[model samples]
Target chain A: MYLCISVLVVFFQMELLTLPALRRMAICGGTHGNEMTGVYLVQEMARRQKEEGDKAWPVPLVLVLSNPRAMQECRRYIETDLNRCFTSAILSFPITDSTPYEIRRAHELNALLGPKDSKEAVDVLCDLHNTTANMGVTLIAYSPNEWICLHIYKYLKGKMTLAPVRLFMVNIPKNEAYSLESVGKNGFSLEVGPQPHGVLRADIYNYMKEAIELSVEWIGLFNSGVMIEGGEVDAYVFHKSIDYPRDPESKQITAAVHPQLQDQDFCCLKSGDPVFLSFSGETVCYKEEEALYPFFINECAYYEKGIAFHLARKTTLKIPSVRVQRN
Target chain B: MYLCISVLVVFFQMELLTLPALRRMAICGGTHGNEMTGVYLVQEMARRQKEEGDKAWPVPLVLVLSNPRAMQECRRYIETDLNRCFTSAILSFPITDSTPYEIRRAHELNALLGPKDSKEAVDVLCDLHNTTANMGVTLIAYSPNEWICLHIYKYLKGKMTLAPVRLFMVNIPKNEAYSLESVGKNGFSLEVGPQPHGVLRADIYNYMKEAIELSVEWIGLFNSGVMIEGGEVDAYVFHKSIDYPRDPESKQITAAVHPQLQDQDFCCLKSGDPVFLSFSGETVCYKEEEALYPFFINECAYYEKGIAFHLARKTTLKIPSVRVQRN
Candidate 1:
């Protein structure tokens, strides 16, 4: 009887830890300016807010366009990648006249929506992004154990019918998480694609809009004292990134993503599978011993970052269910 | 007998006018720097020339990288589009300190490959280009009556098994022709694509390489006194350009190319067909009375040019058979 009582007490404490009511949320877009779906979605929402007012949302929500200058020029970024400038170390850097444009912008954003890792930060943040690679709809989380993000991914996976929904965990520590989404207490990014930079596709734009709507709906249900149930979700955990083959002397790429592997993101790649095709008509094969899922294959923005594609190992995550804690 | 003799004399003169052998040919690439197929093909040909000493060609061939500064930066152009700076009026514009970099580069290219409309110009010039639209292997010509270009287009249609080959005529007068191709006596552009700017696709690259190789082979056959047989071919003549729906106040695009029309280049569009989808979920239909084929649909580069797509009217042209004129 004593052992049973101890087990019940442990379960009660775990539910207490999981049930904080989310009071405020933030949705950010244009972190990478050339990703048009997010930029337009944010604009669309702002227009709707002006017309309908905030009575539609159950929780207080803030909309952000992260990089206005880059969006104006239809470029990925103006000075440096804004999405990569949000780690605590970088955010704390002393401001100078010669500081990069994105770094300064990061500080202003942190002050607005984040203090990063503080209780005053928004309860949740969803930063919208797009990729040239055919990744479909992906929820990218900084931590595998982020229950709010994982539950949202599970909900989106069940709701999204136009394309396959996936969860990808970058698995970085909270303090070292570098994306704009990391500013909030429970943050993640929704990345969708095959959309080209500086161009908009209606289908892709629709998919993104649907995703944001569903995400907001899920947040509302959880905040309104509804018991949100969670279960096991399969996530692709990032392993490593591969770079394209390049000429040693000139540093120019000597090959392109092989036709067989192009647009096959999230497919298991085994050893000896074709990965790249040299400009001289030679096929370069994957050399890894173990089979792994590949994603973000041949992303246009990653060319400058020296990443051809990223490899990830699939793992199942367990999520806890709970109702909002009563004061 | 007098009537028959007059007809024979006219036919003889026409054959004589068409039979001049192509002595010097130029292959130019990188007029738009983000077009990887052209940039890489030029680099590959240059490397081959260094290795093989140009002994493989049937005539003197010049391989030109038209805009080196733009190519270096991987942008469409440094200041102004190099391809549009080739008309006689623009080419003859006196050099000034404030002249756009591409305009200055155009003068240098014209000096090397042309003295346009003169016998000193290269006999044939083939410019390579790429577009973000699904325009499968197009030969863009300045005139419908350029038999050399028509015959080459026919030959490519026969030889290219990977993609459909079609001819597109801009029909601009020779003196006012605004593209780089018009610098030579007989010139046309080999445009292929659906490739994103700053990204390379192996299949698209191979299609372009095969097209260039077949063009050079056709040149060799003609220069060696072969009778090149020709036939009637369908060509799309430029009609008009359509712009995306935009807000009057900010001039910001309010719509994207509808999903139905996104990659449907060369497909016939009827009046009242779906064309643009507004951010507010409204369908904007095509309002033209006449049915027309559309190309360059949602081209990323054309966003700044205010072109959503270009319409064309399909017309058939007759090509003439000819053998080299010998001294």
Candidate 2:
């Protein structure tokens, strides 16, 4: 369980292995305070990489464990779910005098990933997380517009049991929301499986291990390459669900594919409606007559958009916040 | 203009002032690289506070300017708007290793505000900026519920020509996107006026000067007041704009309000246009609306459900890495 804490304390103290002329790739696990598979996998990877020596990782690999304190506590961040705090206005934890352990880790990781002046420090970022419900191995690559993301995906597909996914939607028009859609960077939230699920963690670990290897291969091909085999992934079967929350503000104007049921669900949504369920064990209810109800196409789970659904609303939905161009 | 170039360099050099008994408040100006009014005011306040010889601010004030480089460059954080980088992931700027200057400032401020271990910091975050089109003073408080916000509003109103004017719909389902929305915390984004035109540096200076003063007062109340006065601004304005971005992964399932446009606008939007523009710029052509349109509400604008127009969007939005639950 003991691992190499990154040496450079100013930034991220990633378990380090130095390789000259090497590109560094950072893999983030357990971005969700509740999702800890990524943390477990990254820790394993860091341990293995450290053991295998620098040559084992063709590139320098930084394994990041998001919200370690939360991970230890088995919740997201202690008081606040750290995943939401990444907006522009709010970066670290909301601590005035003493920050929670998680915020301090975030600052450290941020500095290490991209030190104030060191542009060439960490090159690639891959965020690993798990879903509340059952999900397959997937990569959330929101950096399609960028060649770096494209190449990373290629490598990822080539190496891992990844299912290529089109980001169904993003939380747009809001500040500091992170996703492939928001930050045009090549980062994805790997929805391995439900938290504390052993099978899911194993799957996540294997896939991440492969991803690190492929990430190195991808970086190797960046500037100089003989054009060897690139990466390709399986089609990730997505469960058709809009992860948007039923907030009072959005609820007013949001034309839920089914407006009537939307309110009811928001007001009193239980569990097991159809599309998705929340980690808090809330089920979404829906009417069979609505066009978007049950959220399935021809009995196949479809991830047309990417909002996590805690409950089902009986309605046809147009996914919002998916395609904002960075100006 | 030779104010101290080293102010940029001295950013990290300053020791993190840790005083747990002291309430924590961080005021950031120039989040938008070009918005300098808050910066001017904060610096002046810092100097005056020093001159007044207050050993410790009534509250430990963490004064920060978001984008020193962009401010120096005189443009919104170009590669990536720094404001948008705080969410789940710090975005990758176009130029590799080129994080927005504001992001760097955010990191530095986060550290200084609370080193995570300090016990006395209060994280009273205020981001100050200037808007070019609007001619009003606005505060975007980060109150999660209605009651607390009303108190924040009342306190702010007494300090300035403050009006609780709602701006163009933020697509966030709830107020989670703003840093201040966290419970028991005071975070707000202040918009002064049309940048470089309406508010001169001196005018901004006055605004900043008073803000620092009011912040001190507010902190003192929190620290020692038996019964805090003016606690009535808690009626939550739940206005959801059509533009709210929805991120399903966050633990807080809140919705945002969107404005319902008229026939003149969104005419092309059929009953089920998937990615419809709920609140595009009023002045711009229908076809011309993409993201980042300048469609602020004009004079004699209607204020229904507490929504505003013509206000600029924060750089980005996402789930905070931490989640806090309130009793």
Best by lDDT: 1
Which DockQ value does candidate 2 get?
0.01
Task: Give candidate 2's error at residue A74 in angstroms.
Answer: 2.3
Q: Which digits, one per residue and each the tens of the lDDT, describe model 2 over residues A1-327?
A: 123333323223231222223256777766554454565556556657777888766666777776666665444446554555444454434546576555555555655664312454355677776543333444444322333544455556545654332222232442445431222123445554322211122334444456655666766654343333322222222224543334475341111122223212223333434432322224444534433322111110111132433322332221111111222
iRMSD for each candidate structure, in the order shown: 0.9, 26.1
DockQ of each: 0.65, 0.01
- Structure candidate 1, residue pairs in collision: none
Query: B83-161, model 1: which lDDT tens digit per residue?
Result: 9998999988999999989898989988998888888999899999988888989999999878778878888999998
The CAPRI classification for model 2 reads as incorrect
Instruction: Quote the lDDT for B40 in model 2.
Output: 55
Worst 10 residues of 2 chain A by lDDT: A295-304
Instruction: Give me the runs in candidate 2 sitting further than 4 Å from their true place.
Output: A1-22, A92-95, A98-101, A115-121, A158-186, A194-201, A227-327, B1-327
Could you give me the TM-score of model 1 versus the true structure? 0.94
Instruction: For model 1, state the Cα shift of residue B39 in Å.
Output: 1.1
User: What is candidate 1's lDDT per residue for A99-135, written digit by digit as tens?
Assistant: 9999999999999998998888999999999998899
Report the C-alpha displacement of residue B325, candidate 2, in angstroms.
Answer: 53
